[model samples]
Target: MAELTLLQAINKALEQQMEKDKSVVVFGEDAGFEGGVFRVTAGLQKKFGEDRVFDTPIAEAAIVGNAIGMAINGLKPVAEIQFSGFMFPGYNQIVTHAARMRNRSRGKYGVPMVVRMPYGGGLRALEHHSESLETLFAHIPGLKLVIPSTPYDAKGLMIAAIQDPDPVIFMEPKRIYRAFKQEVPDQEYKVEIGKARVVKKGEGMTVVAWGAMMRETQKALKRLEKENIDVELIDLRTIAPLDYDTVLESVKKTGRLLVVSEQVKSLGIASELITRANEEAFLYLEAPPMRVTGHDITVPLPKGEHHHMVDEKRIAHTIKKLANYEV
Candidate 1:
C-alpha cells in the first residue's frame, strides 16, 4: 500500500486503465497539455501520448457529444467537463444520447463512457467552479452516478466507472483533493458502483452524507462525541441507486437520521434520502429525518458561502434537536 492524495489516486487510476485497455481514451479541455485546471490529469498526455490522451476545444457539448459517438463505436472514452456547472452544456447529449442510446437501440448500441467533473464548494472558488449537482443526474434514468469521498474511493471508483457498460457521471470532491493522504493500493483495484462505505460506526443518530460534506460531517461527529453523542457516520459514496440497505440499516439502529450536504435543499439529494427513509424506514424512526443542507439559492460569493453552507455548527444543532427535542 502507498499513500496518495485524491488527485494522485485519480491520476494513477487513469494511467492504469489506459495501460490495461487499448480502447480507453481520455479527452477534454486542458486534459492533455495542462493536465486540467486542477491538474488532475497532469502528465497523462505526455505519458499516454497524444492519440490516447489529447486536448479538445473549450466546448462541453462537443466533448460529451463526441464521447457518446466514441462509446457507440466501441471505444471507452473518459471525458472531463471542467466543472459541475459546465456539464449543463452537455446535459441534452448525456440524457438523450449517451444515456438513452443503449435502451433506445435495445442493446444494439451503448456508451461505456465516464464523464468526470470536479465538484462541490468550500474551495473559495468563483461561480461555476463549485456546484454539487449529483441529485440532478441521479434523478435521470439510464445514467449511473458515482461520488468519491476519499483517495481510495476516487481511484477505485474511477476505474470501475470507465469499465462500466453504460454512461457514468463521476463527481469528485474537489475540496478534499489534497485534504489528506491515505494508503491506496498501487496495483489494479476497483470499488463497485452504487455501494456506500460505513466510515464510522456508533449507536446514536446516523449522520448520512457524501462528497465534500463528508469532511464537515467528520468534524461535527467529533464535536457531538464530546457531548456524549455516539453518532454513526455513513459516507454515501454513491448517490444514484443509493446503498439504501446500508443507510436504512444504520437508520434502523440509531432510530434517527440526519442527511447533510452542500447542495441546495430544494429537490436535492438530501430530499431524496429523506423520502426514501420515509417510505422504507418510517416506523423505525425516533425522530423525523432531518437535513442540514445549503439554502435554495445561488451559491454566494466567497465572503457569504459560510452562511449558506452546512458546517459543524449546523450539524451539531440538528443532532441536538433530534436527540433532545420532540420529533
Candidate 2:
C-alpha cells in the first residue's frame, strides 16, 4: 500500500489498467505530452508510449467521438475532457452515440469507454472551469456517472470504469485532487459502480454527499459532534445507478435525511435522492428531506463565488436546524 493523493491515485489506476489490458488507451486534450490540465495523467505517456497514450485536438466532440469508435472496435479508450463545463460541446456525441451504442445495436456492440473530467467548485477557477454538471449526464440513459471522494476509491473506481462493458462518465472533483491523501493498495482493485459508501454510521440522521461536498460535509459532521449531534454520513460514489438500498436503509434507521451537493438545488442529485426517499421510505421520515446545495444560477466569478458554494458552516447550520425540527 502507498499513501497517495487523489490525483496520484488516478494516474496510478490508469497506469495499472493499461499495463494489465493492452486494449486500454488514454487520450484527451494535452493528456499525453502535458499529462492533462491537472497532471492526473502525469507520466502515463512515458510508461505506455505514444500508441497507448496520446493527445488530441482541443475539440471535446472529436475527442469523445473518436473514443466511441475506438471502443466499438475493441479498444478501451479513456477520454478526458479538461473540465466538466467544457463537456457541453461534446454532449451531442456523448448522449447520442456513446451512451446509446450498446442499446442502439441491440447488444451487438457496446461502448466500453470512460469519459473522465474534473468537476465542481471551491477551486476559484474561471466561469467554465468550475461547473458541477453531473446531474445533466446522470439524466441520460445508458450512461454511468461516478464521483469519488477519496484517494482509495478514486483508484479503485477508475479501474472499474475502464473494465465496465458500457460507457461511464467519471467525474473527478478537482477541488479535492490534492486536498487529502489515503493509503491505496499498490495492486489493482475495483470499487463497484452503482454503490454508495457509508463513511460514518449514526442513528440521529443521514447526511449524503459526494465529490468535494463530501469533504465539506465531513468537516461539518466533526463540528456537530461537539454538540452531540450524531449523524450517518454516506458518500455516494456513483450517481446514475444510485445505491438506493444503502440510502434507504440508513434513512430507515435515522428517520431523517439531508443531501448536499455543489450543484444547483433544483432538479439536481439532491432532488432525485429526496424523491427516492419519499417513494421508498416516506413513512420513516421524521422531517421532510433537506438539501444544502448551490444556487440555481451560473457559478459566480471568483469575487462572488463564496455566495454560491456550500461550505462547512452552511452544512452544519442546516443539519442543526433539521435535527431540531419537530415534524
Candidate 3:
C-alpha cells in the first residue's frame, strides 16, 4: 500500500491500466509530454512512450471522435478533456456516437472508452474552468458518470472505468486533486461502478455528497460533532447509476435527508436524490429533505468564486437545519 493524493492516484490508475492492457492508449490536449494540465499524466508518456500515451491538438472534437473510432476497432482509448466545461466541443461526438454505439449496433459492439475530465468548482479558477456539469452526462443513457472524492476511490473507480465495456465520463474534481492523500493498495483493484460509500453511520440525518464537496461536508460533520447531531454521510461516487439503495436505506433510518453539491441546485443530482427519497421513502421522512448547493448562474470568476462554493459553514448550517426541523 502507498499513500497517494487524488492526482497521483489517477495517474497511477492510468499507468497500471496501460501496462496491463496493450490496447489502452491515452491522449488529450497536452495530455502526453506535458502530462496534462495538472500533471495527472506526468510520467505516463515517458513510461509508455508516445505511441500509447501521447498528446493531441487543441481540437476536442477530434480527440473524442478518434477515441470512438479506436474503441470500435479493439483499442481501449482513454481520452482526456482539459476541463469538463470545455468538453462541449466534443459533446456531440460523445452523445451521438460514443454513448450510443453499443445500442446503435444492437449490442454487436461496445465503446470501451473513458473520457477523463477535471470538473467542478472550488479553487478560484477562471469562469470557463469551473463548472459542475454531472447532470449533463448522467442525463444521457448508456453513458456512465463517475466522480471520486478520495484518492482510494479515485484509483479504484478509474481502473473500473477503464475496464468497462461501454463509454464512461470520468469526472475528477480538480479542487481536491492535491488537497489530501490516502493510503491505497499498490496492486490493481476496482470499486464497482454504481455504488455509494458510507463514510459514517448516524441516526440523526442522512447527508449525501461527492467529489470536492465531500471534504467540506466532512469538516461540517466534525463541527457538528459537539452539537450532538448524529449524521450519516454518504459519498455518491457514481452519479448516473446512483446507488439509490444505499441513500434510500440511510434516509429511511435517519428520517431526514440533506444533499450537498457545488453545482447549481436546479435540475441537479440533489433534486434527483430528493425526488427518489420522496417516491421510495416519503413516509420515512420526519422533515422535508434539504439541499445546500451552488447558485444557478454561469459559474463565477476567480474573484467571486467563493460565493458559489459549498463550504463548511454552509454545510454545517444546513445540517443543523435538517437536524432541528420538525413537522
Candidate 4:
C-alpha cells in the first residue's frame, strides 16, 4: 500500500483497468495528453498508448455518443467530461440512450461504460464547473452515480464502476481531489456498488453524506463529540439505487436522521433519504428527519460561494439542533 491522494487513486484505477482489460478505452477533452483539468487521469495516455487512451474534440455530445457506440459494440469506454456542469451536452445521450440501452434490448445489450466528471463546489470555479447536480443522474434508472471522498474509495469504487455492466456516472469531488491522502493498496480492488459504508457509529442520530461534504460532516461530528452528541455517520458511496437498507437500519437504531448533500434541497438526495426514513423508520424516529444542503440557486461566482457552500459550522449547528430537539 502507498499513500495516494484521491486524484492519484483514480489514475491508478484507470491504469490498472486498462492494463487488465483490452476493452477499456479512456478519452475526454484534454483528458489524454494533458491528463485532465485536475490531472486525475494523469499519466494514463502515456502508459496505455494513444490507441487505448486519447483526447477528443470539445464536443460533449459527440464524446458521450462515441462512448455509447463503443460500449454496446463490446468496448468498456471510460469517457470524461471536463466538469460535471458541462455534461449537459452529453446529458441527453446518457439519459435517453446509455441509460435505456439495456432495457430497450431486453437484456440483449448492456452499456458497460463509465462516464467520469469532477463535480461540486469549493473549487471556486466558473458557472459550469462546480455544479453538484447528482439528483439528475440519480433520477435516471439505468445509470449508477458514485462520488468518492477518499483515496481508498476513489480507487475501489472506480474499479467497480469500470467493471459494471451498465452505465455508471462517476462524479469526482474536485474539492477533495488532492485535499488529502490515504494509504490505498497498490492493487486492483472493487468496492461493491449500491452499498453504503458506515463511517462511524452513534446512538443519537444517523448522518448521511458523500463526496466533499463527508469531510466537512466529519469535522462537525468531531465538534459535537465534545457536546456528547453521539451521531452515526454514513457515506452514501453510490447515489442511485441507494443502499437504503443500511440507512433505514441506522435510522431505526438512532431514532433520528440528518442527510447532507451539496445539491439544491428540492427533490434532492436529501429529500429522498428523509422520505425513506419516514416510510421505513417512522415509528423509530425521536425527531423529524432533517437535512443541511446547498441552496436552490446556481452555485454562485467565487466571491459568493462561501455563502452557498456547506461547511462544518452549518453542519454542526444542524446536527446539534436535531440531536437535541425534543419531539
Candidate 5:
C-alpha cells in the first residue's frame, strides 16, 4: 500500500484495468496526449500505446455515441466527457441508447462502459466547468451514477465500474481531486457499487453526503465534536442505486436525518433521501428530515460561488439546530 492522491489513484485504476483487459480503451478530449485536463490519465498512452489510449475531437455527442457502439461490440470503453456540464450534448445517446440497449435488446447486448467526468465546484472553474448535474442522469433508468470522495474509493469504484455490465456515470469531484492523500492498496479490489459507507458511528443524528460535499460535511462534524454532538456520517458512494437500507438503519437509531449535496435543491438526491426517510423511518423521527444543499438556481460564477455552495458553517449550523430540537 502507498499513500496516493485521488488523481493518482484514478490514473492507477485505469492503468491496471487496461493492463488486465485488452478490450479496455481510454479516449476523450486531451485524454491521451494531455493525460486529461487534470492529468488523471497521465502516462497511459506511453505505456499502452496510441491504439489503446488516444485522444478524441471536442464533440461530446460523438464521443458517447461511439462508446455505446464499442460496448455493444464486446469492447469496454471508458470515455471521459472533460467536464460534467459538457455531458449535455451527449444526453440523447446516453438516455436513448447506451442506457436502454440491454433492455431494448432483451438481454442480447450490454453497454459495459464507464463515462468519467469531473463535477462540482470549489475549483474556481468557469461556468460550464463547475456544474453538479448528477440528478439529471440519475433520473434515467439503467444508468448507474457513482461519486467517490476518497482516493481509496476512487480506485476501487473505478475498477468496479469498468467491470460492471451496464453504463456507469463516474462523477469525480474536482474539488477533492487532489485535496488530500490516503493509503491505497496496490492490489486490485472492489468497493461494491450501490453500497453506502458509514464513516462514523453515533446515536444523536445521521449526516449523509457524497462526493466533495462529504469533505465539507466532515469539517462540520469535526466542529460539532467539540460540543459533544455525536452524529453518524454516511457516504452514499453510488447515487443512482442509493443504499437506502444503510440510511434507514441509521435514521432508526438516531431519529434525525440531514442530507447535504452540491446539486441544487429541487427534485434532486437530497429530496429523494428526505422522501425515503419519511416513507421508511417516519415513526422513528424526532424531527422532520433536514437538507443543507445548494439553492435552486444555476451554479453561480466562481466570484460568487461561495454564497451558493454548501460549506462547513452552513452544515454545522443546521446540525446544531436539528440537535437542539425538542420534539
Candidate 6:
C-alpha cells in the first residue's frame, strides 16, 4: 500500500493504465503540456509522448467527438473536460454519439472511453466550476456515472472506469483533492463502477451522499454522535446504476434515510434513491426518506453559495424527524 492524495492517486492510476494498455490515449486542453489545471494528468505528456498524451484545440466538442472516433477505431481514449460546467459544449456528443454508438451499431462498435470531470461544490471556486450534474448524465441510457469520494476509491474507480466496455463519466469531488491521505494498493486494483461503499456503520439512520457532500455527511455523523445518533454513512460511488442492495440493507436496518448531495433537490440523484426506496423498501422505512440537497436554483457564487448548499444542520433535522416520527 502507498499513501497518496486524491489527485495523486488519480495521476498514478492514469499513468499505470497508460503503461499497461497501448490502446489508452489521453487528451484535453492543457493536459499535455500544462498537466491540466488541477495537475491530475501531470507528467504523462513527457512519459507517453505527444501522439498518445497530447493536447487538442480549446474546444470541448472536438475533444469529445474525436474521442468517439478514436474509440470506434479500436483506441481507448480518455478525454478530460476541464470543469463540470464546461462540459455542456460536448453534452450533445455524449448523449447522441458516444452513448448511442454501441446500441446503434448493435455491438459492432464500442466507445470504451472515459470522460473525466471535476464536480461538486465547497471549494470556494470560481462560478460554474463546481456543479453536481451526475443526475443528468445518469438519466441518459448509454452513459455510466461514477463519483470517487476518497483517494483509495479514486484510484480504483478510475481504473475500473477506464476498463469499462461502455462510456463512463467519471466525476471527481474537487474539494477533497488534498483533504487527507489514504493508503492505496501499490499494484493494480479496480473498484467496481456500480457499487456503494459503507464508510461508517450504525443502526439509527442511514445517511447517503456522494462527492463533496460526503464530507459534510461525515461531519454530520460526528455531530449526531453527541446526541447518541448512530448514523450509517453510504458513499454512493456510482450514480447511474446505484448499488440498491447496499442502500436497501442499510435502510432496512436503520428504518430511516437522509440523503445528502451537492446537486439541486429537483430531479437529482437523491430523488432517484428516494424513489427506489419507495419501490423496494417502503414498508421497512419508519419514516419517509428526506433529501437535504442544494436548492433548486443556479449554482451560486462563493459568498452566498454556502447558504444554498446542504450541511449538517439540515441532515440533523432530517434525522430528528425520522427518530421522532409518530407514523
TM-scores for the candidates = 0.98, 0.99, 0.99, 0.99, 0.99, 0.97
Candidate that beats the other on TM-score, 3 or 6, i.e. the better one: 3
Q: What's the CA error at residue 244 for candidate 6, in Å?
A: 1.1
- Superpose all Cα atoms of candidate 4 onto the true structure and report the RMSD in Å to 1 decimal: 0.8
- Per-residue error (Å), model 4, residue 26: 0.3
Candidate 3 C-alpha error for residue 305, in Å: 1.8
TM-score of 1: 0.98
Q: List the residue pairs that clash in candidate 6.
A: none
For candidate 2, write residues 1-327 as lDDT tens digits. Answer: 999999999999999999999999999999999899899998999998999888998999999999999999989999999998899878899999988888978999999999999988888888888888898899999999999999999999999999999999999999999998999999989999999999998999999999999999999988887788889999999998999999999999999999999998799999999999999999999999999999999899998999999999999999999899895
lDDT of 5 by residue, 1-327 (tens): 999999899999999999999999999999999899899999999999998898999999999999999999989999999998889888889999988998989999999999999998878888888788999889999999999999999999999999999999999998899999999999999989999999999999999999999999999988877888889999999998989999999999999999998888889999999999999999999999999988988889989998889999999999999999887
Which residue pairs in candidate 2 collide? none
Off by over 4 Å in 4: none
Which stretch of 10 consecutive residues in model 4 shows the poorest summed lDDT?
A: 122-131
The candidate, 2 or 6, that scores higher on lDDT is 2
Question: How much lDDT does each candidate structure score?
Answer: 0.89, 0.93, 0.94, 0.92, 0.93, 0.88
**Model 3 scores what on Cα lDDT?**
0.94
Lowest-sum lDDT 10-residue window in model 2: 221-230
C-alpha lDDT (0 to 100) for residue 21 of candidate 6: 98
Question: TM-score of model 6 relative to the true fold?
Answer: 0.97
**TM-score, predicted candidate 4 vs. hidden true structure:** 0.99
Q: Candidate 1 clashing pairs?
A: none
Estimate, for each residue in 1-327, the C-alpha lDDT of model 4 and write its tens digit: 999999999999999999899999999999989988888778988888998888899999999999999999989999999988889999999999999999999999899999999989988788777788999999999999999888999999999999999999999998998899999999888999999999998888899999999999999987777798888899999998799999999999999999988887789999999998989899999998999988888888999988888999999999989978996
Encode model 3's per-residue lDDT on 108-151: one tens digit a residue: 98999999999988777876888999999999999999999999
